[model samples]
Target: MEDHTAGHNKEKRYECDVCGKAWQQPYLLKIHRRVHTGERPYVCSICDKSFMRTQELKKHRRLHSGEKPYGCSTCGKRFARLSGLWVHRPVHSSERPYTCSDCGKGFKLSTDLKVHRRLHTGERPYTCSDCGKGFTRSTSLLEHRHTHTGERPYTCSQCGEGYIRAKSLRAHQRTHTGERPFICAKCGKSYTRSTSLREHQCTHTGECPYTCAQCGKGFTRSTRLLSHQRVHTGDRPVPSTVCGGGLAMASHVLSHQRVHTSGQPYDCPYCGEAFDSSRELRQHRRAHAGEQMLPLQQTFQEHAGAAGAPADTHQRVTL
Candidate 1:
């Protein structure tokens, strides 16, 4: 009765020194301290797994026993915990009580609405300790930590290829199954992933959402825009291992390396002609297709004109 009175009166007498968490009961405070001390008093006899609380141990035991005590009244779905039933209850109903003020988005759960609000607020509460990278969600931050640890928990059974995320593994498995689930409504083209389908849809819309600040050049993808910006910035992030020469792109490094070894790796199937790089090979293939190939200077002049820049604006005679 005293415990009930204390809880009803909103009185928390027991407080932890470490985290300053108040509890109505002394025993509850003792259990809370175990979280800071890393002490697990309750042990599962079957699995030998330890838990901070006895209730957690009881929940863990249900996994081995295959016991689900909680049941939904709507769909008759069984759950091991009461919290799971509470979370599942909303799925049966079309009602969304929790609404976001900013985006006018509705969510069934308040916790989900709170996370969605962070997107509008630009609030990244979760941060990485390794590289100091910030993430909007805790799950995203947890996935980012796997990069530093080099852990790929989700693996493909057929090909033995590992991925950091389960979604990536599922997407890669489609390659083996030949499943293209995501289809474009415009062209009726299919893709393994939804992101690829969205990118392809941009071609039909002719929406160049990503634009370069320097040249005013537009691109369908953000990666293409970033690559175009590097041309203006002269940001040679990739360096040649052979000659230590700075190259604008990582793909260009292979061609630059061939200059030192005099290796013509790319070969034309039509004329049996070998080239140092894939770019030259592609140009060689255009000739075989009877396509009029423009000279290097003329091509550069046309590109400069499209970019609203003079032909001699970036000309440099390398000695």
Candidate 2:
């Protein structure tokens, strides 16, 4: 009779019924069957988290042990599993295989495509238990929970300002470093944020995707759409502390606060009077230059869906 437990050089006898992938052992083929059956047989003793395969459970246990054995040959970056190293390969190759059907954007991984699809669908699956606010990803919801808990894990090295997310801290650092990486293709204006650059591009294309349902007025920013809707609804939720005047967007509240700060650097060349933002300065300068105010630069959101930030709040603009 043949030696039943010879060695690793055994013949590939077991074949998967779904994909036709062959393995050396019967138990290995049974574990592979979980790909089709959605079976998680291996359970972690520490967290009780189930995994489809024993190897997967072993890799996941590294989360508790803080062990990352797989190291990238190129960058020396560590990962818990070999599959992570496989996914990291595309980062060096500049290869993006996954494409979004809605926007025709490319991503390196299918998981990224899944997240990007939510932007088009407006589907926020991850929700905050505290406020019932929805987020596209769990990471966003995790960062948002910091507003309630008063947690600032990411801190700036220069000015020591704390942020809940690393991305926010990176963006805030740009204010000090003057790192405007995102450049407008049309106007040559650079912005620290890609969203700001895209918003600037809309001026060249005149593409206002956001439109008011009541008045049919087109706006480039979603914040402006929220502000415009208040006119129809007659809602004034955000109130100014200096005056009893209602504010629509957080930008209005900031601009109103400037009336009290008295340290405005943006002074009019024509009148020597100061204003808070460039938009206000330009509007004031237009009067002296005998030029009509364009009413441009509409997007003004102070805090987007934050605890203290004005969300769905209307400001009563007194004419």
Candidate 3:
């Protein structure tokens, strides 16, 4: 009798010397070696996220550029990739041809049913190296690794603010653009992000899920609870990038770092005035539009003094 398992192993065309892993293709073997070599040649120009393959990098670039080349003929709604358009096609029709044996859930796409089966089988193919958190999707695992590495690839070109997720960068960019896309159905007020709209919606519902143990104070958002606890514990976790140990919120930290970096990247299109951050630029615009505004951050004034004067002097002398 012939040993079939050994024969299958012998059939593998390419093998890695370091790990002794065999692959059917030479290109696959070359890509597998990158895991050991720590070589990521394909870099995203929009952010700094690196990829092992050229195709993976190309797919990622569409997220930043918002390019949906694949369009559906039935509805004309577009997607970044062909696979997305294929997945979307089932939604228009009543036909759900693929059925999951485990839970009897019918899906239009075979891929969707395959993913749903993983939930029943408890098979998570994607995993994190740091904490070993398993996710079904590779994209979710890629986003999860950023928390462990502190690798914020997506950055705001407006204020040099770094963000771990592209979606966060998009939301932050809206602030610079003065875009209020997320509108409240109840109050008719608009917000830059959906999270802000959700938090505001909770106010109307009177949903106080987050409760403080110290004073029994209830809050809508966990961040509001953390801020309230700061008054009691005096634990300001967010550290300042400008001066050491001058802890504040993440928003305030970026606003403060402008003085250190001398970054007045936000340029007014109306009057060509430059400001340190988007908030500052917004206030400056309001002045130009003849609107009443409040005082600017005190840190902006403190910069006019010695600690900040050098950066201003340098920019003035250079520009």
Candidate 4:
């Protein structure tokens, strides 16, 4: 009754000197002080992972047990925790109460809006202790630490392949299932990933959003744009292991290594011809289709002359 009266009266008697955060109960204050002290009392027996709270340790155990007790009332989607289900509930509705002042982007939760605002402000509160890399979120910082520790917790049951992230494991599982969930609305082409679908849609719309500042060459993807920029700068970050030759892209290094070994691993389905690289195999396939093939360097040279050309006018290069 006294605890209820303290909460009802908004009287936080127990206060933390470290962060000046007050709690109604002494036990609640003790739990809150763990954040500042970096103390984790609860430990998972399965993974030997430690948590500050017993409830958090109980939730972490669900990952090993695969126990999803919380179910969404709308879509019947199951979650390990009630907070996950609460976060997902907004997805069924169009309502986004939280709005960003900088970008005018709407989010379902105020916490999401706060995170989105960090992008505009260039505020990265979380920092890695090893490499000193900064991230906008604590989760990203935690993931970055895996690189130093080489800890891949997520694993595939079929292939025994391990991944640092759960999302990467889920995407890899799609290859075995042959699940192309994302579909192109115009051409009806399907892809395993949503980003692949968005890149494919750019081909239909002729949208080359990523443009080169030097030659004004537009590319459908930022990766392609970065590769093209390397051509102008003569910046070959990837080095060939065999000859110690610098290559613009990592794929080029693989192709270069095959030259030393005289290896032709990529075989053509149409013809019995083999190529050292997948790019060569793809270009060779176009020959069977009777499609006019333009040399990659020639295409780049031609586009380089036409500076500030319209995005629609830029030829799409599949690299």
Candidate 5:
């Protein structure tokens, strides 16, 4: 009987009837059967989180220990789990495997694709308990937590600026380091972030794909058009640049440029001195003395006289 048992010891095979899954080990087969039975024996003492498999519970306990074994080769970022490091691998490769069904937008991971799909469905599950601000993912909520807690763990070594997220800190450090990794293919202009470079590329392409239904005004990006259409409804402030003498748009700057070149064509003929701009002429007509222009250069004289030396001390010393 001992010789027969020793021969048959390695020949054991077990299969689950419910799932029709086969396992070589009886212990593995018993574990597999729990999936069908929905029985979770392993439970976390701290959080009351239950796991059907003991292996999953063992992996989850690493979060409590704060053990991040898997590290990214490109950024040297450590992740709590192997799956997190697996998801982060494409960032270094710049790979977008997941594509959006609604807008055909691509993402590096399926989790990002899931967030993009929420825009089509308008689903924002993660919400702020205090202000009721909704977000698609919990990571956004974690970042938003900094707004309340003021807890910025990530700090830049160069500028000494703190950020809630490591990505934001990395981007901020580029400002001090003068590092622009994302380069434009057409203009050769570089940006610290890829999103900024992508938005800049639209200017070279002349692709104003986002159009307004009311004014028919086109915008290269959705955010730009959203801010622009708000002008009609007075929902937001009129955006302006200081370089254009306080003009709202580039087209407005072009018109202002023509006014400057034409020596203020709509100016008052009473004034003998012609103005370069219409706004300048309008302010001149008001007789309100314009604000004092700030001096561009700081004037400094030689400090040889103040150093207990005469103005002609060099000639006296030579004689």
Candidate 6:
């Protein structure tokens, strides 16, 4: 059995003169004594940054060297420190021990639990030193600092993919793994993450919650509406993907070619007949099943009313 320090050493001993408190370990007491003396012995070679503890200085140096020695054996995800890998491993394992007191949202790490607590408390302590923008956590402030510094140190070895944060890098690595954890309970549509799955679910429900102020068009996902709004604002995309075909939305690239094609690749499972568009295929399936068509003009009018847009503002056909 391991020695029980609390049971054996109950008597007060090794007291700090500054705080009038005792310590279990003399090494811890010695380290605590440095606060009174204002001594930071451990120094970095790259930036000459100093830390009270040697371990803290060692971790700080890894930020400069881009060294992630600790790696997950299962997912091949890497971390600068073992503690970070410890926190990250649970995501792969789907182990959520920590939960929110307010909403009962489960999280793997205690740090995530603390960050989630801010939703209940509304406590923002970490304010940006440069811009005075407030964040609930110190990690958020650190990420916000990257915006000012424009530092994206994390670069992928495979495809030279870059990210501002380590967590984003981890998520980007999943693209190679083909691991889609989030699945739609209703449609069986799979996504790499829960957020994407939620957005995909909205398409089936016909729920376009985000409204564009300029065109008065509503989108199911906020990201979609944000991208659509860019069309008006003259925000051209950086062209991540290349194609010979001229298309607007990346999602419509495969579907839009039906205007010229003789063979319809998309087929109605109910009738086994091919259709030009997926929407047409859906309508065809409904027709075979003896379902009445919702009045297209009336549906467009309802959608326009919901988006706070005039029906004549944009030439939109309801499918």
lDDT of 6 by residue, 1-319 (tens): 2458656766756889989878767888899999899899999988988999999998999999999999999989899999888878878767788988776779888888997787568788999887676777787678767755657667777888666777667667779888777799998888876668877887788666677776555566544675565444433322112112223233332233332243554432222334657587566645532343223333222433455644442223334
Candidate 4 TM-score, true structure as reference:
0.60
Local distance difference test, each candidate: 0.68, 0.67, 0.68, 0.69, 0.61, 0.63
State the lDDT of candidate 2 residue by residue for 1-319, as single tens digits: 3565665568798999899999988988998898899888899999999999777788889999999999999988899988889988777777788999987879998998998888789899999898687788899788878755767898999988777778878888999999998898777999998777877887899787887665566676565576666545544455555434444433344355554356664533222344667777666644432243223232222222233444333221111
Model 2 clash number: 2
Candidate 5 lDDT score at position 54: 81
Using TM-score as the yardstick, the better of models 3 and 6 is 6
Clashing pairs in 4: none
Residue pairs clashing in model 1 are none
lDDT of 2 at 43: 98
After superposing candidate 4 on the true structure, give the runs of residues whose Cα lies further than 4 Å from its correct spot: 1-7, 10-23, 29-39, 74-76, 94-155, 160-165, 213-224, 238-262, 265-274, 277-319
The sequence of per-residue lDDT tens digits that candidate 4 reaches over residues 1-319 is 9987766899788999988888888999999988889999899998899999998999999999999999999989999999999989998889999998875879998898998888778888999887576778899788767755657788999999777777878888999999998899898999988778887887888777787776565676555776666555656555444334345554343344444355554533222244767788677646432343223443321332344433332223333
Clashing pairs in 5: none
Error of 1 at 11 (Å): 14
What TM-score does candidate 3 reach?
A: 0.42
Residue 84 error, candidate 1, Å = 2.8
Q: What's the CA error at residue 274 for candidate 3, in Å?
A: 19
Give the TM-score ranking, best first.
4, 2, 6, 1, 5, 3
Best by lDDT: 4
> What's the number of clashes in each of the models?
0, 2, 0, 0, 0, 0
Cα error of candidate 5 at position 188, Å: 1.5
Model 3 segments beyond 4 Å from truth? 1-66, 70-78, 82-165, 215-217, 246-251, 258-319
Mark the 10 consecutive residues where model 1 has the least summed lDDT.
292-301
Candidate 2 ranges with C-alpha deviation above 4 Å: 1-108, 119-122, 214-319
lDDT of 3 by residue, 131-247 (tens): 676777788788767755657899899899798779989998998999998898998999998878887887899767787776666666555666555544544454433334333
